[model samples]
Target chain A: MQIYLPIAELPISIFLVLGIGAAVGFISGMFGVGGGFLMTPLLIFIGIPPAVAVATETAQIAASSMTGAIAYWRRRALDFKLGGVLLAGGVVGTVLGVAFFNAMRRLGQLDLVITLSYITLLGSVGGLMLTESLKAMLSARKGISAPLGRAGHPWYFGLPLRMRFNRSKLYVSVLPLLFLAILIGFAGAVLGIGGGFLMVPALIYLFRVPTAVVVGTSLFQILFTMLAAIMLHAATNQSVDIILAMLLVFGGVFGAQFGARAGQNIRGDHFRLLLALIVLAVGVRFASEIVLRPDELFSLGLIEIRR
Target chain B: MRRAALALLACWWAAAARAETMVLSLSSHRVQITSTYTGAELVIFGVIDNERRSVTRQEPYDVVVTAAGPRASTVVRQKVRLGPIWMNLAQRKFADVPTTLAQISSRPIVQIASPDLRRRFGLGLDSILDPAGYDLIYDPTFRTALIRLQREAGLYRSEERGVTFITPSIFRAVVPVPATAPLGGYDVDVALFSGGVLLAREDTNFEVTKVGFEQAVAQAARQHPIWYGAATALMSVAFGWLATVIFRRD
Candidate 1:
């Protein structure tokens, strides 16, 4: 089936788009990542305009995060106090990111910035995940329980404006949490991500939150952050493609539902390793495009019609 | 120039002999862009009334048909290697360039007209790009890139010797409009050339417009962006809720 995207002014295969959404959604649900690291790049590979892909993907992320956050809310696993503080910083970061995005777009350098950021982010995160998961898998096979590592460094705890988050059983400084949230928030807004991969690790390692509560807290913060991004892109840039967003949301919501059940049957360490491999593969492919010469060195864009 | 003048005089005499100079029609004048619009082809056919002229040994009349979509500004960006990566370094803006262009002729355009004539009529792809209208500096690569990219995208085409003559005075050509072609008024120009000179010319209009659901959606997205944005967010959230409801039953 062929569907015409109004904003992008192009016709795309309906089934192809649905399949991409489902695949990314399944991976995100199974691994507890937001999947934007994979989804935004895939959308661009399939010829969706970069601006539309970024804005529309953010809209879809907002929808998917809402579903995940609700499930965690029902389970009483979300740390509202920590999530709220992160969101406060996230709002400020999103505004700055939007301005930066607009500036890059005007200079015709937005595509370069987006590709470079993805390459940097996915490369480091995927590499770390692969090593950590491999060690965990090896330890499990040897029938040895690995002791829980210390969550935070002394400097992170020494920051001012300390607050107690009873839900995670941690008393952490608000400054570090706010600073981390701002950084992730900027990344989420610019990269069209929910920042789950970055947030989950930060929550567990930097703030010393319980691993059990990290996924829920990350999803809660991501929901609000992506919601703000969607509105900003729509109102300011008018780049969000509703048709594209709806198709992705439809496939993503259903895929995540099925994926969650499939996740229950798999070993945690094995799935983590698999997801890490996929992330690293995507990052490598992105990097190769930059390091390699393009088939066509020149490109054209229709002048933006401002009414 | 002398030959062109004689050809014009002959065409005037032929027109004086008959009431009709030429008759032109298209397969479709209004192209409706529905949800299933993949592409379209217009069969441009015309009849030349050469009734008064003797059917003796003479040069066969050549047909050249050109179609251009609505004009708009376009920007072409050239990438330069900067350190480790290639980035957009310079941009050239072109004004009044057609979003889509298709030209079909009975013979190779070069054979039918001289370089000056081709440029004057905007016949061949190379010379059709108006040099005076672009930015201050004249770079041949930018012009070539613009046409090359558009052609690759199926928005521009030049099909030499594509027109066929079924009868002595009737000719037809098929012009293809790609799926990505913009929606607007398309101008089709048909010219009859004899002895390498233009004899008779006719102009027709082809309209491509969005209809039904496609029109409504495109209009709302452009005109009422705030409402459209709110609706998109709401719909996405609803989809998520619907999925949760369906799956939670398990």
Candidate 2:
């Protein structure tokens, strides 16, 4: 069935949107990551306005992470101290991201920026994840244990404002952690991604946070950051479509449950490998869109110059 | 409600200044767009009273009905190839351009009247979009691009023989309004022609508006941005919590 989206001012097939949401939600649940990285681009491909797609996907991620944060909390896996420091920095990043979004739109370069960011970030993340997961799977087959965290001290260890996080058992400068979170929050707000996929790896490899606490800490930071993003996009850009978000949430929630169950049967390395491939596939698709010549070279728009 | 169906608003300037008179009525004066609204059609039917004894030329009266939605400033951008990537580099902005423009006539617009008359009266989409009040014509590149894009979007259209004549005096036309049409008052201007001469003309307008849930949602987003944003956040969070509780994988 077709339904008119009020804020987006467009008509779209309701079933298609739900289907996309379901597929992405299943991935999110299976991987224990926010599906924003996959969803925002899919929505754009299906002809939703880029601004609306980005903002609405954040709402869906917010919903997914809310449940995730709570689950980790009850299991005593969440690191509140680490999460709090990240949240403090995340707020600042969210504001800056939205401001940047508004300025790009004013310059009529928002689409270019969105495409560029997707290509660069997704390509790098996908490539890194693929190599790392493949190495882990290979080492496991040979019955070799995974190496310890890192051989030498990282450069970030010497930064100012050093603090201890007991939950992750780390004593490092809060500066790098805060900076990592700010980047994650900014990506979440502007790209409509959960940033968990990126954050989990960063926390493990860069900050040397425990793998057990990575998912929970990332979820905590994403939930609030996406919340702020949804509100800011609504207040400033008026791009958040509540009805669109609700439709996605319904499909995503159910898909996630089934996905989580399905994920339980897969090995850790195998699951990561699969997720990595999907991420790279999406990144490649975006790359092709940018490089390939389009059928139409002219685009039309209403310049609502809010003077 | 689908339509207001207001009573006929007859000719504003007809018969008094010319030999013939015309009266027009729309199937609906207002269209209410609810959630289920896909698209709608506005019916324009009218009659010509040329039976006056003094009126002699009655070869065949031709009706040209042009409907234009409220004017708004718009921009059309062209993408230039920058190495391997193509990006929008050149843009032309048109001020006071009709959001939607449709011309429906009994026959081809070109065959209806002289080029001078068509240009003067703004009879077709091309005529209506023609930049005015300058000895130098605006760049044809931008103008053609605007028409091409708008036509692709179903915003600007021209349909010869869209208007049908039931009798020698009565004619009817249907203007298809796509759901993507911008919300605003749409002006319908009709001009009557006979034997390559302008006989009578009349113009009236109607409105397209969102009603019910659609209206409420659109209004909330624009008027209470902060509240709307907060409510959206609250809803998503609650839904997430609910999903976790219901599923309970852990």
Candidate 3:
């Protein structure tokens, strides 16, 4: 049933929203990741405003992550020191990201930038995951460990501003981390993503941070970054609807809890493969928009702006 | 006990014997009608006083204006409630509710459109009957016509609970005259009803007049391409972002 709520006056189909929440929650519980990569678009498809969707999604992520973080802390799985470092960088990155976001808005090209970035990043990550997972699955059927690539050493290593990351057991400089943080920050600000996908891989492959510490630290950084984003958007635009956020967050917390438990039981390779497929499907759908023409694109003026 | 009863009876008799009358006048008694979009406005003014004693309580009133013509009819209603004399008796727990005086004095002007006029302007069929839908088409022309009708309708007065009353109120109601509405001389009647009973009536004449600003803007917006383009572009960007976020993977 559709209901008019006083808070936002949004005509919400409560049943539909809850059902979507349950399904997404289940997936998120099974996977050790935020389901925003899926939920935001689904909301839009159902006619929620885009700005409302993104702002609400961030609020949902905050709640979900808080629940997971608490559970992990209770179980002694959290690495406080590692989480702290990431958070420090994340805060700085968020500040810079918000600045960039405002500048883009003034240019009236913020939307274009956000769209292009999502397409490129989602497309690449999805493709990579799919390929790697497929290969792993094929190799496992033959009773063989897939060949792993060694970390290649560059001949000239004269990069400046090196810093030691004790938890990762690496002596890499601070420069790369700063650069990576800045890029992630921009993505976070523009897309309202936590940038965990990018951070996780970078932490594992580049810094060689232990896999156990990776998820925990990344979640920590995301928590800080997302909070900053929520605050910035709220204070500047008054665009964050508390009602919408509350609904998504209510669903997300339980989803994350279930996902964490499921992650423990599932085989890592198989889980990764499923995630890869889901990502690839989303990527293709997004790319199709650019390739396909829409029906009845309307305009009121002489110079037509095609969307 | 006998003395107390006698005093109470005497007070009741005195209050009943002293009834007050108030006079209300409008600046313009007749207004020219125009396109569905325009009309003459009447300014209403009046006074109230108790014949026996100064009224300690403020009076409440309602104004209604209606128009009738061939093919369409419309009504505009405004209400005012004066503050009670006993307002200082308590801390005013119901501050949110408007006072009787406030309701009668000033109100958002109401617009009424004849069904034929609405159709002529392409206002669609549903808007004519639905209050919400009608509000969506509240153009300047309709508003002006409403104001004019209210001005011409003159003063209305009513009493509720005998002690509280309305004086010198104004109302306008619109009705469609038949296709044979007289070109130069149209007889307009104004009637006052209290407790649903006719208290007074007046007759006047009017001539219909031309279109206004709001109608023109709405027409231009509909015909212009640039406006549509801008609106679409904004919607796409908003929707596009939503699509990307929802489909993104961890």
Top-scoring candidate (TM-score): 2
The DockQ values of the predictions, listed in order, are 0.50, 0.50, 0.02
lDDT of 3 by residue, B1-250 (tens): 7556755764674454334444444455333322222223333433433445543324333222222221222222211122311111111111111000001212221222234323322222222223432334443433333333333332111112112123344332333332112123333333333322222334444443212432232233345434432332233233323422453343
Indicate the residue-level lDDT of B84 in model 3: 19
lDDT of 3 at B138: 47
Among all candidates shown, the one with the greatest DockQ: 2
DockQ: the better of candidates 2 and 3: 2
For model 3, residues A124-243, the per-residue Cα lDDT tens digits are: 887777788788888899999975546663322236765555655656556666667767766776666777767877777566677777776676667666776666655443345454
How close is every model to the real structure, measured as TM-score?
0.90, 0.93, 0.53
TM-score, prediction 2: 0.93
Candidate 3: TM-score of chain A is: 0.85
Which residue segments of model 3 deviate by more than 4 Å?
A1-9, A75-77, A99-111, A152-158, A299-307, B1-250
lDDT of 2 at B240: 95
Candidate 2 residue runs with Cα over 4 Å from true position: A146-149, A305-307, B1-17, B133-138
Error of 1 at A182 (Å): 2.5
Candidate 3: what lDDT?
A: 0.49
